[model samples]
Target: MKTAVVLLPGLNRDRDMIAALTKISGTPPVTIWQTETEIADDIDLVVVPGGFSYGDYLRCGAIAARMPVLRALKEKAERGTRVIGVCNGFQILVEAGLLPGALMRNASLKFVCREVKLEVANASTSFTSGYTQGQIIRCPVAHHDGNYVADETTLKSIEDKGQVVFRYAEGTNPNGSMNDIAGIVNEAGNVLGMMPHPENLIEAAHGGDDGRALFAAALEVAA
Candidate 1:
């Protein structure tokens, strides 16, 4: 009942994610570098942290998504592993084809770094289970390519299946994401991707503890 956080060369938040999980899940999470080809057998959750992977080359997460570790991650995800991707990690998941849609340059054409109000669109998924449906929470976002876009048909399909996990609050939509979508989960409900940094809010000293529940909910870490 352990959990693991996969580390990309440029991923810098592994420790923070570990601490978050330890706080709520009551189990210390280990960091598995990208060089590693497989997750530890005892891992119950796999977290992909946010950072400038491959220095944001041609695309935010394009290079990192092709790393050997991602292929292993994809296999585990297919087997129903709980996967959480934040910011650049989210970009990688999309690039890896584990999730849908692409994160383009912010609609403002600027890097946004501020606390944003988000609505919990669906709380049934492992990542959002701690939140009540429609709950509003504030979390900080920092990125240049947080804008989310996809074909209308795909958007409608996801919505129909209740895959949307979070949405920017009305009037607080920092990016021009379609319908203000802020985060989403795959149909399996085991993979979640979002631009906001939940790892940053697991402690009140950092401003809010709204993110603690996400890790607690996703990691059934008893070891």
Candidate 2:
């Protein structure tokens, strides 16, 4: 995929994201700085990697969400370009209004950094096509404000539309997210927001390749 990984001032995972995208696309992904007002026209996928953007000041993703690049991202997402936000990126998505709901302080009030099981709640989207519905995959989660919360009406609507892409598996609600939602897609399915770090689990050295399917599916769409 022709991808761009956003780099925010406080983001710490740009290298990891860049490495993963390079391995998947066979080329280094473009890096878009927070100050950039536009994303490359040729980019097919935009990834927002996990990190403490803006040092989690004010709110986890508040400052970063207002960065210039997100305006471009919102435009691209509205135009049907695919975007995926992992971890803090997910928080940014919510704060930027690209995705629904908000991420709150973990119910436990503790930082959670561990591998958690996730189930493919919906596999019809491009990002999840490599997995079957109800399939289980293990991905790592490392964030303090990863608790996903939304009004009951919105939650029901998303569920009814199959926008809940991934859910924490049995006995695996590590952050006490509502309905155990680990990830979700926008109404159009071109945007995804998830708290898990799939990039961390994509290589053989990472002990498993369960997360490879996600990038493979996205790359296929871009190709």
Candidate 3:
């Protein structure tokens, strides 16, 4: 499968995402700059990696969401292409209106960098199909604004539709997110946004490969 990584200033995790995709798919993903207005239709997956884009000015991912690339990304998503946004990328997706809800500052009001347990709340989505329902996996998170929030109606809608894909498990909630949501997919199930950094824990060298199945499933490759 062909993949592309969106690049924006201050996004430090692009390289990690690139490396993971290369290792998993056996090919380097195309790099899409912030100004690029179009994404090739051949690209099967497009990932917006985690980091403080625009230095988190005016809110996480606020500025990056307005980039020309995001417009094209929205178009791609409308056409049913798969998209994953991690951490700040998750913030950007919400800001850009590609996904629902908002990511607020961590309830602790301090940066958090640690491993958290995530339960596969909805394993039927494209991104979580490799895992089984109710499975718990370890994933690392590094961010200051990982809190996920949504209005009551919106929250209920997503939950009712099984869009909530990952949730903090075993009292591992680090951000006080509503319903302990750690990740979610769009109504169409083609777009996903999450606060965890799965790219960081996708290899044995990183302790274990619990996160590899996600990328493999998204990339249509063997886990």
Candidate 4:
């Protein structure tokens, strides 16, 4: 599959994401700089990795959302190009109006960095096809603004539509997100936004392979 990873200023996880994509996809992913106004054609998936973008000056991902790359991303998403955003990338997706809800400060007012169990809430989408519904997978989450907040009605709508792809399992909600929402997909299922870093857990060296299914599933969909 042809994949592209968008890179923005202040993004510290680009190398990690690049390594993950290379190991999983068997090919180096194209790196799209934030200043670029267009995404490459023939791209099957676009990945927005986690990190403090633009120094998180205003709000995490607030400035990165306005970068030129997102315009191309939005257009590609509308055309059914699969998009996955992790952590701060999730914040950027919400800020760019590609997804619903907002991420607020952690209820504890602290930066949480640790492994958390996530339940596959919806396994039929492109992003979760490799896992069974309700299956728990361990992944690490590191962020302060990972608290997902949305109106009850909106939450209900996404839930009813099966757009809620992943949820914190049991007591694994490290960010105090509303409804324990750890990941969600767009109405069309081509876009996903999640707080956990699956790319950080794809190898045994990272502790477990629970997160491999995510990349494998997306690759299958793109194939």
Candidate 3: deviation at residue 202, Å?
A: 1.2
Positional deviation of residue 34's Cα in model 4 after best superposition, in angstroms: 0.6
Report the lDDT tens digits of candidate 4 across residue range 56-173: 8898899999999998899999999999999999999999989999999998999999999999999999889999989998999999999999999998999899999999997988
The global Cα lDDT (0 to 1) of model 1 is 0.86
Per residue, candidate 2 scores C-alpha lDDT tens digits across 1-223 of 5898999988887788888888878989988988899887789999998899888999999999998999999998999999999999999999999999999999999999898999999999999999999999999989999889999999999999999999999789888899999999999999999999888888889998788889879889332
The segments of candidate 2 whose C-alpha lies over 4 angstroms from its true place after superposition are 221-223
The whole-model C-alpha lDDT of candidate 2 against the native structure comes to 0.91
Taking all chains together, each candidate's TM-score versus the true structure is: 0.95, 0.97, 0.99, 0.97
lDDT of residue 125 for candidate 4:
96
Q: Candidate 3: lDDT over CA atoms?
A: 0.96
Cα deviation in Å at residue 132, candidate 4?
0.4
> lDDT of each model, Cα atoms only?
0.86, 0.91, 0.96, 0.91
Per residue, candidate 1 scores C-alpha lDDT tens digits across 1-223 of: 5788888887776777778777777767887778778876677888888888999899999999999899999999999988999999899999998998889999999989898999999998878878899999988898888898888888998999999999999578887888898899998999999999888987769877887777767764321
CA lDDT, candidate 1, residue 174 = 85
lDDT of 4: 0.91
> After superposing candidate 3, which stretches have Cα over 4 Å from the reference?
none
